[model samples]
Target chain A: MKAFTVEQGIVAPMDRANIDTDMIIPKQFLKSIKRTGFGPNLFDELRYLDVGQPGMDNSKRPLNESFVLNQPRYQGASVLLARENFGCGSSREHAPWALDDYGFRAVIAPSFADIFYNNCFKNGLLPIVLDDAIVDQLFSEVAATEGYQLTVDLSEQVVVTPGEERFAFEVDAFRKHCLLNGLDDIGLTLQEADKIKNYEQQRKAVTPWLFADV
Target chain B: MGKTLYDKLWDAHVVDTRDDGTSLLYIDRQLLHEVTSPQAFEGLRIAGRKPWRIAANLATPDHNVPTSAAERTQGINGIADPVSKIQVQTLDDNCNEFGVMQFAMGDQRQGIVHVVGPEQGATLPGMTVVCGDSHTATHGAFAALAHGIGTSEVEHVLATQCLLQRKMKNMLVQVNGKVGPGITGKDIVLHVIGVIGTAGGNGCAIEFAGEAIRDLSMEGRMSVCNMAIEAGARVGLVAVDEKTIDYLKDRPFAPKAEQWQQAVDYWRTLVSDADAQFDKVVEINASDIEPQVSWGTSPEMVVPVSGKVPALAQAKSDVQRKDWQRAYEYMGLAPEQSIESIQLDRVFIGSCTNSRIEDIRAAAAVAKGRKVASSVKQAMVVPGSGLVKAQAEAEGLHEVLLEAGFEWREPGCSMCLAMNADRLGAGEHCASTSNRNFEGRQGFGGRTHLVSPAMAAAAAIAGHFVDVRTMVEEA
Candidate 1:
């Protein structure tokens, strides 16, 4: 995985709130646990009127021309600007996988659900929490200027606008370090292998019954 | 130096602290299910490593497991979906290969792993429980510090008995006064979510306490804690009480007599002091809560059953307005329609959230003599566990349900999710007692309105989503 400091990316604003994980990637696409293939199918239900069928008429498909994702200006967008309470509902990690796979390097929102926010950092996606006014400003700027690009510097923890309107956001130092290094919870745990091994030895001696095979 | 239940549990499980201040917390029990475990099991096989503590870990095939026993008995080849069959079979094979105990398809112990763990005493008080399921916080009713982990973290826990972790900030949520009649644990959680909003509890471990919480039964407490994730809390807990002790006694994995007494003594000390400190605190009067039902897609968008759907223009914030519009469009609900007047196509009363024996008994009490309305498509009663199902059947609750025209099904995650054949057809709406009400949560284009089991039963009889209080009063 290539880790970038997120220098600059176009912000495609999605004005809807409570945009759930299922909407990000529906249940039918959840058949495969492999994280890579899900990006293309993200929002398949909303994008296509009839999914998973051959020779289906696309002429009658409900084309949501107003949707930020479907707009030609936001095509190949790397930064997603969403409203508050984004990524609610299920804790499926596929939501972040789809976001990352769709080439979104960072997500700027007023708030995010606890599980989805945590899942984002682990999957090499940055979820930045900004003030409501700041979020509104970002949305307005994106609406006014097509394909607006904002630079996010992980080293400085600041999001800089096109006009150099920079706002600093706070993230846990450890989590920031993990995201910078592309280390997940498991990768971090594996770094302490010696300590884990020693604990296992001591625990085995104390509770021998637990070590026995069925 | 008074210790909250969280403090005692965290202290007991701390194996060591590294130089960076991260604790190597030893997990006493590791629970696994079908969805998150397959990838972790694959990681283990690729690395050629067995479970570090095989006896301490347990696996169950839920989530993707077919609730219908007949379908399950027909084997993997008999299933319509090849992927679900593969997922279940992989879990079965992994458990056998690793010599870990598994509650498989036909096993009586099989259920939602979160439900099965506590009911069987595999989740003990003061133990650090880790599961590859987000609702693992359901085990916190027993005073266990249970939390969910990711797939890679599951692999780490299997190879090493410890998990690398950062500590959460503490928050005390005190629900005071007595709960009014007709309100259940599901209502309490929904009301709490509404008060706190979805993101209010972020970065904190919430302790549900005070008189109202203390009065709840073990199952009721589990239901309350189960939805903590819905409110953005990392962990939700309740102190061990007599109800907890009583529930744990005689279970297969519980401590023996002498050890049990000692364990209870330790549990008694797990309560917070009168002046215990918390980083954040929220107080709610239980009496103020009503029969809450979700009007919008998110849990936090719920209101009292007597309330009407909210208009987007009346929403307090722009985001709220947009969310209201989106939810309204997807749910096919009018902003001014009375929530109680909305007709229901189906009623699903099961899942880890509200599928306990008490939940069934509560629902059956409402459906005893009443007949389900003909307009209702299907009203199904699925117990959380086979043990619960058997117990309910012995009490003639199943007969009462069938007599009332509700389909009785075997235990699994039936209809709470669209997985399996138990699903609502296109454009169908349901009165579900499950935790989430997101669009297509039940099936593609299937609308869900979360309510209490009693409320669900009443809806089944009335053939529309209505308050159970009215039914109780009429009876």
Candidate 2:
């Protein structure tokens, strides 16, 4: 897990709504056993013209130049700006993996799919939910500037733009702490090992059949 | 105090709680599919951990399985796509190494994880169930608390057999009055989604109540609960009843003999108390819900089968207008056009949503004595599971479908997703019974119109959507 502190990065806006995980990284790219190297295939269907096989040279593939991420200005953009229901479909954690792999540190949306939102925090990606109007303002601000960037401060729970405009956001304190300290879900659960063990004992007593494999 | 079904299930499963309303809830069962489990197993290996309770896990490679591929035991040799074959193989290896039960391809029980679980009696009433697949909501028909979990949460549950979660608000969608003839569970759910909109049920556990829901078969109940995700609710349930018990009797995984009586005794108490309060409630008259059809890219963009598509000016909001415009363009549809008049190049009759025995019978009933339209390049009926396929075959349902020019294929989530070789090519229009209708959902540049199996079958024969009830009357 990577500890996320305050950082400024250019914003790339994806204007579509209900952008499901299947589109973020199609099922074909999900074949790989390991988590890494998904950056190239991020939005594989929307990013590339031809079919993307495992281990193919992505550089030679015809890039969907019209897509937001493939555009010249948005290149190297670490902040993703988007609309509502940003990750709805399958509960594939690969959606966040592809987003993080594509060099995004944060995703700002009016709303996000529940599972995708949860997966983002676990993978060290900051998913900030804001009011629709605030998101609209950010989109306009990014469009107005040539190299727009926003600074997200977890400790302060705010995002700042180039004009020194501050937008407050709410995050669960525990989630904020975990993201700031680079704690994944497994790591946090392990901290409460004793409690979990005690619960397991109680569960066994009530439902002993659960402990034995059939 | 009176309690809702959601409350009863949650309160029973709470192992611990915190100040912020988060609770560590015990999971009674975890269903695993190939698409989502690989990463979780990899995470387990990285963390150097084993599944907390192997007995609690049941897995099968469904989403990417080639339905026509060799028998269950033959390994990946039957699959041609290296990527898909490897994905299924990885599950086989992972399950074998970890000692988790694997229903490998060719096994009669190998089917959609959601369908197999309930049929085998692994999905019991009053239990907390989680699956990596969103359709896990299907299991909630037995009066259980079930929802989809992400891969990380999958790994968490695999390691701890519990989830750290906040309780969702309870919602009761009461459907009063009897449904008119030709309406099925699919129509009821589609109507609900249409009335509530896509995000209407977000962050709520929606319980289907009223006489309409109570009268549905177990399979029909599963169909409605299965598409709860389409309405933006992760959890959907119906109170357990005699229908649920009758369906569960003497199944392979069910508690046997004396224990079964005790289990039924417990399940009987799992329904919402009469005086229980829900945070939100919506009412619908079942007679008002006709067989439905989706005319656009989103599931919520739906209308009754007998209705005409809305004109662009009818969109209530700018966002909706934009979405409607895109959907119209992508689906090659026009406003004011009748849904029945729209042509289809293909049709699909499977998915966890509508792939049970009853669903097949419904479609077969419509397909019998009807020949498919020539314009339909392909019309396929894929069963939900191998067992479903076998039973359908024995009952001559497959013959009825085949005689009607429908390709009666084996089970698995074939063509519901484009992961497998069974998918639509560019610009193909398909009347699909699968859950989603998002852009590029079926395949890139393909158009999907979500419908019921009966509707899809009718579309296959008519080359477009038709009033299935009208056909029944004509017959």
Candidate 3:
């Protein structure tokens, strides 16, 4: 996993709310458990009108002109702005994989479901929670401008807009430390290896049956 | 000080408190399934470790197992899908290597891990159960502190007989009084979600209490607790009662004679005290609740069947209004349509959430001697487990379902969330007893309306949503 700090990227705004994991990547694309190759199918049902077929010529298809994703200006966007209660259903880890594969390094939303938010961190996608007012400002600014860009400084905990508009966001101290260091939940657990080993040894002595069959 | 059932269960499981304010908790039972176990077993192998408590762990294959016999062997073989096949093979190998008990494909005990664990008596009161599947909270019906964990956490629990975690604040949700004649446990849960919204119980462990809960059968209690995640609870529990004890007696894992008396004595203490304090308390009167059906994508978008579909402007918050608008556009539902009058193209009566024998019988009772509507293309009834299937067949529920044009299939998670081949075609609307009604939850672009099994059956016969009580009265 690469651990480079994200600095600046063009913004891609998804205006819809309650965009579920199923829509992020439909169940048909989930045939392979391997986490790769899902990025192309991300929003498969929405991006294509015909099932199992990509947008015909990427031009003749009935383009959902209103969809921020279908807009030409947001191509190669790395930052995603979304509404509240995003990623609302099923604990499919593929949702994050699709986002990451689609080249989105960070997601800024008013709020997110617990499971999907946690899964995003594991997959190296930074999900920044902001107040609703800040989210509304970002959405308006991006919608008004032709090509909007935001620079996220992880080391400084700041988001800088195109005209040097700087906004600060708060992250849990521990989670920030983990994100900066690119450590996951397993990595955090492994940090206490000596303590875990000692506990195991002590536990084995008390409950011999636990280790007897092993 | 009085203690709620949540506190009692938490206190019993805590081994020690670490310096960082997290607790070292001992797990009484660890359930495993094929989908999430392969990676964890690979992690264990890489670390050169063995399970600390082999006897406390049980494994089963459910997700990838095909519901039809023709596809079963073909599905299990190293097919084009190498990852799923590897997952199944890894479980088979790991259980044999570790000497842990397993319920493989074709095994009578093989089903959804949550369903199999309880049906086999592996889940008992006061036991802290951990499973890799999120629906593990279904086991909380036995008064156990059951919750799901991620793959890495699964490895940690296997390596050590304990888990590192923080305690949750307690919430008591009391639904008192008797349910109206037609309301089922599924309706009660959907109603609760409707009232509380989807994110109502975040970061809380909910203890479902009061006379209404105590009166439900064990199967009904499981149905209610299974969807607790839909309301954002980490866990949902009911107090141990005589019904709980009766369900656990003489099963494979239940303690024998002498130990049984001691276990029962211990289990009796799992209930809450009369004056138990909770951080939050929400009460609902069961008599006022009606049979519920989801009109939108999220579980919280449900309303009583007697009510009209909610307009976006009627939503309480801006976010809620946006959600309502999005659901309206996606579902093609008008704001003023009565929930009772919406037409349905299909009805599904199976899932980990509501596929037990009781659920099947409930649907069958409504479908008996009544043909499904000509406009309804497909109506399916898939049982949760082989045991449930056999029992329902022995009771002639299968014949009734078939006679009524419902496709009775083998036990598995069929059309619940579309993990299997059974699915709703695009743009189709269905009355489902499954936990979720999210966009394409049953199939891509398929609109789902959540309802009880009897309601699903009734809707199938009527070609639209209908009250089951009216059909019951006519019958």
TM-score of chain B of 1: 0.97
Two-chain complex of model 1, DockQ on C-alpha atoms against the true structure: 0.37
Write the candidate numbers in order of decreasing TM-score: 2, 1, 3
RMSD of each: 2.9, 1.7, 3.6
**Candidate 2 accuracy as lDDT:** 0.86
Candidate 3 chain A has its poorest 10 consecutive residues by lDDT at A205-214
Best by DockQ: 2
lDDT of candidate 1 over B229-250, digit per residue (tens): 7887868899878888899889
Q: Highest TM-score, which number?
A: 2
How would the docking of model 3 be graded? Answer: acceptable
- Residue pairs of candidate 1 with colliding backbone atoms: none
Task: Tell me which of candidates 2 and 3 scores higher on TM-score.
Answer: 2
lDDT of 3 by residue, B372-424 (tens): 99999999998887788888989999999999999988767768877666788
Off by over 4 Å in 2: A200-214, B69-73
Better model by DockQ: candidate 2 vs candidate 3: 2
Candidate 1 off by > 4 Å:
A51-65, A184-188, A197-214, B16-22, B47-50
